[model samples]
Target: MRFYLQACLLTTLLGLYLCISEDSTNQDEKLPTIGVSVLIRNKAHSLPYFFTYLVNLSYPKDRMYIWIHSDFNEDNSIEIIEAWAEEYKSQYNGMYITTNNSSGPLHSGEQHYVKWIPEHFNHVIKLRQQALDFARKQWADYLFMVDADVFLTNPDTLELLLGKKLTVVAPMLLSDGLYSNFWCGMTENYYYLRTDEYKPIREREKTGCFAVPMVHTAVLINLKRTVTDKLTYTHTNLQSYDGPVDDIIIFALSAKWNGVELYVCNDYVYGYVQVPMEENDGIQSDVEQLVNVKLEAISKGTPLFWDPFFSKFVDYPPPSKYGLDEIYMINLARRTTRRELMEQSFKELAMDVKLVEGVDGRTLDFTNLGALGVTLMPNYEDPYHKRPMKTGEIGCFLSHYYIWQEVVEKGYQRVLVLEDDIHFTPYFRIKILLLLSELEDLDWELVYIGRKIMTDDEEMVSRYTSRPGYTYWTLGYILNQSGAQKLINAKPLEKMLPVDEFLPIMFNEHPNDTWKSYFPNRDLKALSAAPLLVHPTHYTGQEGYVSDTEDSIVLDGSAFVDGRIVIDHATSRIIGRINSEL
Candidate 1:
């Protein structure tokens, strides 16, 4: 009995020791090894950028294995791939290059050929299968199949996709228009079906991952699960529409039949750039230009979308260098869509912005107006004849009021306010900073970086000026603490007017006697940057973009033209004008 008890104790201690050792092993488990299979055919021009993208991925290069399959009889793709392999093969776990020595060029379908045919599409599947076989032999944990033309701009793509832990996942790669990686749905005949979720999936709020039937261009497949389940990319023998199917549809259908789920992550901007087809005119030049622009933007720490605009201003520094750390920046966005767009824009400009959830006047309680000591004026008339202030206007006014209250409470020296639809020029921040520095001693109450110079006469006072007439926009402006106090104390809520109109009243005297008068000591010393630094995105409709603000209102024939006419200081001539239809 004593020996048995001692044996039982020893067994229990061994069990506990093994459990602790297993737990520690799990904690320090190695990252999964990824095998990247790329198909290159006549893509020498895009190879440089493609390799750069691969090298910059935020994944362990030592654990990645690359396999390049080139089948083009013409072009320098083979040479480039060979050079890349020689240089980078040592960094990765393994690197392999295979070039088809076929006497004739591989049959790529015509420029406009639809990919529904089996023969034309099977070639790509064969090459992919060959690479997959290689990866399987190497015991890769994951297999990432990527087309040579897909340019990944986001460094965290691999890391993010790995976190999803899905059987198969792909990042949505977008090109010129609606073309992307995933199909929304399929028709009864197995053709691609366009569903309503198509566009919204591309533009929707950063909600979550989306489940889809098919994904291509850049797909990450969990080989560990797939191999265990006996999945193969070469399953083109599957029937779709009563005929042999393409590899993408075949794989998707196979996964579905096997109860495997596929997902596409749209939570963040993946910054994917798909190279245009060769049939497009000047394809080489366009691809080169895009590559240069993207590389430059990355180097400058700016978003890729800003490359085109930034290219226009070669002499000026990138927006990332201009810091607004001293100024409190507030952006008013009502809907999630607006907020997302505004935040993305700010990020591109490297601006640190705080979002103020805009007040929706439609849902506002009228009884609450009494708390602000304000009342809606009865039979109020708008001079522009555009329309009277709606709940939207009330909401806008309240938003400003709330911001002013916070400013007073926090005692911030100055705060920059921006509407959601505002767009900044290349040197907007620099110009605004310069204007502020120039007027530091002027005791200015308000500075308009971009505004409708509603004043009849132009007043120029050392890059700062106050006009006789009232200005009309609140799109982008800076309000000092004094201005905030004056605005809060004015209490225009007694007979509430549009925020723009009420602002002038606060600056001047209350046009009516019912409101509290907090007119400043010096007529609210104000200044406007000449040739405005910023303008509404929908100003001229040159870009054919709609304005959410104007669209919300019911307008008559009145065309509400606003914003300053930008000018070249040296030339003293109009450079750009901001015009809008009411």
Candidate 2:
């Protein structure tokens, strides 16, 4: 009897130990491995958003791994990333994959330097392969490759990806006003439309914007394919070339070679928000005119389309006029002499004033590319002083950077960003000022006339979802104080589209949670704001070349210097030096 009791107790203890051991293993494998790789160039400002996004994803902590690769040696981002990874390792298993010093070396003037200098293109391809290798080593199930700025909005994004066995899940293409290529056409009687004229506007050429549903960012694929197929193919294909495969054309071509079926889901998995502008009179005018026309032209005296979810249009009481004087107009060709046609229009539109004269390098620090020059007017002593010429477009990044960091510190209501070349009609100014007065409480960051020409089709442009006329164009967009500050506050990434492309709408494939910017030019009825016109037809006669010629630059690969615009050997443009003061 004693022996029997001892045996039973030993068996029970052994069973308990086995159960505990199994539980421990299960705990270790908490989340499924989801391999993700991103590129973090010199611009580290975009880092915090990406990190914050990773933190918010609804997935198991131990299951995911992220690799960030940068080119600049020991770039300033090293410390920031090291600190983040150290702090978040317990919760999120993040890794830094750098190629700055790890790769092979080449002889410099005096010392040996790393040879593997991955710029935008080669960097993308390298990172993709690196991700696959890491995944294979980690035995990760899948890989998600995207730009560092991309953020997941739907926490269930991981849940959606779980158990999916696809080669590519192409993210939906959302447009920022800059990249909108599709031209929309409005019917002749677009405003206060009658039933007979409500046909779909057609006869416009389709641009490439909406055609390719697949952008490289937010690409999810099986890990095995990424390693054996994708990586191997890239090496074989681009073996002779030492460039990157980051461009959209390369992405599409690569997917074709790999025979990957692309899937595009519109679940707002990622949100691309940007800083807002204060001068979005185009959108405001459209919304007002559209709503007012609809309400007034109602034969049955019906209220505006009042769907709570979609319909945000509401009528308010008339405004009390303050009798504010009209503001001065700006012209782009003011400094440089323009063609006869542009000059005539300029005079007719009260834009006869020329751009301010060029300033010295000491005053206008164009070399840094971050320092902007502004000349304040005496009468306009208010905050809206400091009118800069091409700086509004070329040096916008710097302008906004300064306004956010300094101007916001002192209580400023708004920041008006104007381009010297833009011409405004009297009606345009009146309607815009009125709209601004009306929507005073609107928490908007960006306001601009989306002037990407409307074609015959009502579906004017692709990439961007629109309401009506004067869609958001990058021509002359404005950002508010908060929007400015946010851009200043956030870390910027080196690899990015122009400022126009980086705006909220264009920033990501998905929409953002906190919509920081808006183009309120939805009202087709109100034609008062500046008419969004086509691109300038003429270039200044500075380049007096009757025929094309070729020019080239020689580089020692020692130090970098910026002189007259130098087109690299890669670009499609014929290499040449036109006469230019720069």
Q: Which candidate is the best by TM-score?
A: 1
* Candidate No. with top lDDT: 1
Q: Write the per-residue lDDT of candidate 1 for residues 1-582, one digit (tens) a residue.
A: 999999999999999999999999888678999999998876665676677678778899888989888874455667777877886788888888887757244464534322224555777778777777788888999899998766678888899999998889998765534667888898876668989887888654444789987787889989888433455566644444252446776677777767877888888656555544443444344444344334333322343442222232222224432332233333344455556656555554456667677776445554445455645544355666635445566677777788888878988777788877666654444466677677667767777776776656666766444442466767777887888887767655655667777766655623443322433332566666776776665554544454433444321122222212233457543222234421
At residue 366, candidate 1 shows an lDDT of 41
Total clashing pairs in model 1? 5
TM-score of each: 0.51, 0.37
- What lDDT does candidate 2 reach at residue 545? 21
Summed backbone clashes in each candidate are 5, 47
For model 1, the stretches where C-alpha displacement exceeds 4 angstroms are: 2-27, 101-119, 226-228, 236-244, 275-582
Q: How far off is residue 165 in model 1, in Å?
A: 1.1
For model 2, the stretches where C-alpha displacement exceeds 4 angstroms are 1-31, 73-76, 99-120, 173-175, 178-213, 224-251, 273-582
* Candidate 1, run of 10 with poorest lDDT: 555-564
